[model samples]
Target: MSSSIPVSTLRRFHRSTLHPRNTSRTMATKVERSPAGEGADFRPPWFYTVARVLSWTLIPATGFYGVFIYDFGDHEHVFQPARRWAERQKAAFLTLSAEEKKIVGNETASTKP
Candidate 1:
């Protein structure tokens, strides 16, 4: 009167139906390569090599020149505001009384726990 199959019966049924006993061989075959220098190994054109070498040389050279040689002088508008602010702060610090300078210096040196 039981409707459920046993675990062994279910496993045997799954093994026979879900998986085949023998697998079929594949139809694909491997391709044979052309021998040595008959275009098996290819070299790029001369200009491509020259362009690659120039790119490797010129890009780093341009970056180093920009970092070390190029100067903006008075035309450096981006940093001018910050430079002016620093100058004003230095003037203000110089104008402070000796006691005020001591207080400011101590405030910066003290760390809060």
Candidate 2:
């Protein structure tokens, strides 16, 4: 049976199970966020958002969605939150730096595979 399973797949499954799924949302909002009026510029980093979702089986909220942009200068567009990414305060976001805070702040157009 082990031979039929890819090592990577096994690792992923094991990791996910180990983290355990959160049954926080059975019907209402799937994700959660900080209360209104925390920080005017309060938004989570991109990687941080992803990590938050990945880390949890179900995201508590969907405050803001960001898409990665290429250029790294004045031409570059970044940090836009239509919703709130306040939930990032959970371990997944706090670790990031201010610069990271900036990049992730931008609204993402796509997360294409």
**Which candidate gets the maximum lDDT versus the true structure?**
1
Cα displacement (Å) at residue 86, model 2: 56
TM-score of each: 0.28, 0.18
lDDT string for model 1 (1-113, tens) is: 66588989988878755566423221111111555554443544687799999999999999766654556574765556666686788898779888988998898889544
TM for candidate 1 is: 0.28
Summed backbone clashes in each candidate are 0, 14
Candidate 2 per-residue lDDT over residues 23-93, each given as its tens digit: 33421132334345643234455866887777674433222223322334554344423112343545565
Misplaced by over 4 Å in model 1 are 1-44, 74-113
Q: Would you give me the overall lDDT of model 1? A: 0.66
What residue pairs clash in candidate 1, if any at all?
none
Please state the error at residue 64 of candidate 1 in Å.
0.5
